[model samples]
Target: METYGVWYHEVTRMKGREWMRRLTLAQKPTPLEPLTRLGELLRIDLWVKRDDLTGDMVTGGNKIRKLEYLLADALDKGADTIITTGGPQSNHAKTTAALTKRLGLHPVLLLSGKPPEETTANLLINKLVGAEVHYFFPRHPREMDDALLRLAEEMKAKGRKPYIIPVGGSNGIGTLGYIDAYQEMDQQRQEKQLSFDFEFVTAGSGGTFAGIYMGHQAVQASSKLIGVSPWLPSQEIKERIIDCIKDARTLSTDSVPLSGEPALEDLSIYDQYIGSGYAKPTPEGMKALQIMASEESILLDHVYTAKTMAGLMDLVEKGVIARGSSVLFWHTGGAPGLFALQERWSEWGGG
Candidate 1:
């Protein structure tokens, strides 16, 4: 079978066509290094991929990589306004606003979570960047999609060009961003002569997981990609991610080609750290935030990244990996949302 990823050359050329066209992006090959103290604590040689430093103006996260392609497409289509929806404290929405403002595109953000009492960091930033905020009562996660579609139709009726980016940028096109990260790691492994036993990440919308899964399959990377699910059961997350991978594989191949039923055995999804539900931060996640910051001076958010880090720590403690086995933890930033719960953080001694 032909390889299932874009070359850096192709990745650049593809950037200026279709949705990827007109998408010039900032540099974001974040440093991957060993977390010596935390690794010692867990008895594993743990590493961290610092996506938290990936973008400018606190738009830090794995989402910037995807936005590079997404916004390019929007501009290519001559979109005047960018409309995206998410929770009140969504990292994705906040980053979308920041990037849109930086590129001179109008931003319309729809928020669908609890209304904050004061100006939380994300809310403050959204207003500072002049992105319109629309609120909705906290409801089932599925409601956000309905809201997004309805708003798109309304914008269409008004004759305004709107580009709707799915929550967390989970679609096939955006998922390609993560696949590019895999390519970066492949090059890093060669340059550093690192034998990465496994790659770890917080699995939120499954786009990141799907990218790593498809990239590994295409490049035959030796590292195993393990997804720590912040929400949803392992089985359900795997099914959703598998479907995304299938679609992405088709996109990469330019058509649906012969395949062996989405070979995803190397993908492991663990759901041990999700305490209450989506958006509900856990005590363990809080502790992880404290521990990582104090030990490595690395900050982790409570919602997804810290929870996934907590799971990685647990896996290390239980010897699920191994002593001295190299593992990379992908930090999918949500730190701005940290201020949204500063009171909780102070109470829990997380400052």
Candidate 2:
């Protein structure tokens, strides 16, 4: 095992492959600190990977990791404008908007649903960064993907070199970010002499999970990786992760071959935590937000991380995870998106 420091690396590329290109974005090697309070409450050895603090507070999040590679590819292609799709209050949208602007590239967001009367949370940041947001009511999300491509073509016709990123930046190239992240975490784990029995992460787009899966398999890691999906069903999540892994494998074929691609049955994905639907807050997730904040002094957004935490808590309570097991929660960052649901805070609690 080799030790790597910080996020900075020399200009790395395999020919003109976008997946191989990366820009330094995150603070690197985020703290893998013990969550003693939460651990005691859950009766397990709980810890958190503070990826929420990957960058500055205003633009910080796990998405920055993916953007480092994705945006680098955009710049490599001489892209003046970046386009992506997400919900109206997506953290990815806000993060992309802020970071792209910092790099002097314009961001255009194709968001589902109409603009809200109150521009708060991530949406507020999108406005602050002056991101060009196109609001629409999409019956299906694929419509937004089509819109994004069309928007890119329109921009190209206008002499604006545009780059299009899929929802959540979860593509083959962006997936490389989390592969690096897994190595970083493994290095920290080796240093601390810690080995988690299970590692949990919010699986929205599946790229992050796919990258980590690839890294885990490459290293033959002992800890089991459990992905808790906030939106997609178990089967769908598995398919998306497999797709990402497939696409990512196309970019690099080094000595450490990415063997053992997870079959559908091999994946441990739980979609039960999704109470209602995508982006809708659930009672378990809402309570989880309070529990994490009170116990660990950490905020878990209701849309993603909270649901993942909720799944872990439920598993622990049900004795499925076994008592005294070591568990690590990867905080992929989405606390700002919680502000959009402030109106329902009192209804959910805080009464």
Candidate 3:
């Protein structure tokens, strides 16, 4: 089977089967555009894979790619309701709700944080889609997962077939989405005669990074995949990514034997950009957000893409990324998150 630029044969043919199981939601092969102005400022050949425009306004973002596979699995299992967990303003949860509603399936979101007094951003969109949302102040992050499973059981007992999706859809099944994405990217590169030295992406839940890394590995590509940590520590994100990769390998219809197990050395994760905490707006991140908006009319969310851009700029400034080397910044999309941080926007006088 041929997809994007990849001609799947043998092991890749098995991978294509996994992708064939997915239901289409995203506008496939999102634009790969040159950030000419930003590239000039940084003195590098910089480009962007616009995953932000993957879906409609509310359903747009990187999460939609994962949801295509996840929701398809839910339907295959005869699930009538979907249960997922994420932060209060999670783009994943919002996209899940939007897509689930479109498919005529119920959505139950177990969000980690206190309910806001005034609904806005993702929370507002969730309500608009009529998703049943529950909030919990967990002592540990694992508690949210626990709550999701328990809720699914309760729904099952009440005669509803519920499917549980883990936080950020960062599981073996969802990771396949990005494996397909890598193929799409390679197709674009071949068509444009572009050569990328590095590919930078945000490592939030690790599935996106894992899939991209494994996709590159599957194709034996030379470009280095650098994951910028937006939430977890570098070590933790690395572990999660490795785990996801292993899981994906096992789930594939056929295995491609490796000389040795992929190790930490095989992956590159930078955690320096995660200033303060996960959702907190860092000064550097805010500046990066402003630059994209001003120069390219591209909106980025404070939680993910902004921090990732900040890391990219910092690496360029530090001489880690050479001036003439080509770089591809994967835009994962979380622009609606900007509206969720009204107070921070006011404090920065961005309004």
TM-score of every model versus the real structure: 0.89, 0.93, 0.91
- Candidate 3 structure quality by residue, lDDT tens digits, 24-69: 7788789999999999989999999999999776946889888877
Give lDDT for model 1.
0.76
lDDT of 2 by residue, 1-351 (tens): 012234345357673344367788788888899999989988999989898989765646789888888988887787889999898889898889988887778999989888788888988888888999898776654676788889999998999999999988998888888888888988999999998899999889888998888878777788989999998889988898898888887764433355456689878999999887888888888888899998778998888999999999999999989989999899998898877877788776533
Per-candidate alpha-carbon RMSD to the true structure? 5.4, 4.1, 4.9
Error of 1 at 59 (Å): 3.1
Whole-model lDDT per candidate: 0.76, 0.84, 0.84
lDDT of 1 by residue, 272-316 (tens): 788888768887788888899889998888879988988877777
Candidate 3: the clashing residue pairs are none
Worst 10 residues of 3 by lDDT: 3-12
Worst ten in a row by lDDT for model 1: 1-10
lDDT at 287, model 2: 85
lDDT of candidate 1 at residue 27, scale 0 to 100: 58
